[model samples]
Target: MAEVSAEARIEAPAEKVWAQLTDFTAYGEWNATHTSFPNGGPDTLETGATFVENMKLMGFPAEVTWTVEELETTRVLAIRGKGPMGVNVGTRYALAADGAATTVRIDGEFTGAAVSLMAGKLKDSATAALNESLRKLAGLVT
Candidate 1:
C-alpha cells in the first residue's frame, strides 16, 4: 500500500474552501489528477453517493468508480474507489478552521497488487499531485 498526504493553510474561511472543494464542475481547475467526470459529478454530495471519475497520474489514464464514504459539512469528505488494475483508492479531505484561515489536508491511499510494483513512484507522484492541487485550490479561494 502507498499513503500520501498534503496540507496547506489557505487564507480563507473553511466554508469558502469547502465550497470550492465540493464544486465538482470546477474540480479540474484545482485537482491536478482530475481529467473529467464521465457521467457528471456525483448527483449528491452525501455518503453512499457514487460517481465515475476519469483521472491521469504519472502519464497513465484511469477511470475510477468512487463511493462517498463520509461527509461532514465544511469539515471532512472521504471517498473510496476502485481503480484500474485492481487498485483500491481512498482519499480524504479534512478542513480545520482557524479564525480567518483554514487548514486543508488531503490524505490518499493506494493498495492492491498493482501498487506493490511501483509504490515508491506512485507515492511521489501522488504527493506531488496533492501539493499542486492544494496550491491551485488556494489560488481559487484565497
Candidate 2:
C-alpha cells in the first residue's frame, strides 16, 4: 500500500469550497485530471453513492468506478474506487475553515500488485497532481 497527501489553502469560504468539491458532476470543468465523468451525479455525499470517472494518471488514460465511502458536510469526504492496472484506491478530502479562508487536505492511498512496484513514482505524481488540482479549484471557486 502507498499513501500520499497534499494540502492547500484557498482564499474562499468553507461553504464555497465545499460546494465546489462536492459537485462531482461538474468535475471535468475545473479539474484537469479528469477527462470525463459520469453525467449522473451522486444524490448526496453518503456511503454507497456511486459514479465513474475517466482521468489521466502518469500520462495514461484510466477509468475508475467509485463509491462514496464516508462523508460529512464541509468536513470530510472519502471515496473508494477500482481501476485497471490492478488498482484499488481511496481518496479523502478534509476541509477546515478559518474565517474567510479554507484549508483543504487530500489524502489518498493505492494498493495492488502493480502499485507496489511503482509506489514511489505514483506517490510523487499523485502529490503533484493534487497540488495542481487545488490551485485550479481555487481559481474556479474564488
Scored by lDDT, the top model is 1
| Candidate 1 ranges beyond 4 A from true positions | none
Over the stretch 58-124, how does candidate 2's per-residue lDDT look in tens digits? 8889988899988889889999999897899899989999889999998999999999899899888
Winning candidate number (TM-score): 1
Off by over 4 Å in 2: none
- The number of residue pairs in model 1 that clash at the backbone is 0
* Structural similarity to truth (TM-score) of each candidate: 0.99, 0.92
Model 2 lowest lDDT segment of ten: 37-46
lDDT scores for all predictions?
0.98, 0.86
